[model samples]
Target: QSIMMGGLIKKGSNNVESKIPLLGDIPGVGWLFKYGKKSNAKTELLVMITPYVIESDDVLAQYIKKFQEKTQGLRQGLGVKGSTAALSGKTDKPVPPGE
Candidate 1:
């Protein structure tokens, strides 16, 4: 059995504004000569964890083999290059050079 947990945290933001010195003080038409700018920043953090128990090495090996078999043709018919080699069920190790 496996358990998955996830969490997300968000932080609030700050807003700022600015304008021309004297011209900005006037009301109504004064807006024409004033430039205002506001900036808001937000931060978020996400965490996810999965926990599982395996009794022994044999059990782990069995899981790995099963995964390999299940995904044997995962890349088939995707128009990928060298697909024949991918279907060879050689997921556990890299092929040595010079054959």
Candidate 2:
């Protein structure tokens, strides 16, 4: 099975400026007396996930073993002596209520 997700983000900004009406029109000093600003932004994100189906417990066990081997190699390459959970910022400790 597979899942697909997509998103779009849009952002905008507007600025209004004021200066001495007549003096701001002067050619050389106009820039120093007058100001205006505007901005526009957009972003897009796409994510896709595919899952494998295990036929039985044996197959699932084999898959787990292979996944562990790959992750172990990755950890070694990154010189991480800690568990994967540490990298993921997860711990087995229970959280207290309202904390």
Candidate that scores best on lDDT:
2
RMSD of each: 10.6, 8.9
Candidate 1 Cα RMSD (Å): 10.6
Q: Candidate 1: which stretches are off by over 4 Å?
A: 1-4, 11-13, 39-42, 50-99
For candidate 1, write residues 1-99 as lDDT tens digits: 334465566666555556677877788877877666656666655565555578997776776676555555563444333323323455576645422
The regions of model 2 sitting more than 4 angstroms off are: 1-48, 84-99
Alpha carbon lDDT of residue 70, candidate 2?
87
Q: Determine which window of 10 residues in candidate 1 has minimal summed lDDT.
A: 79-88
- Model 1 clashing residue pairs (backbone): none
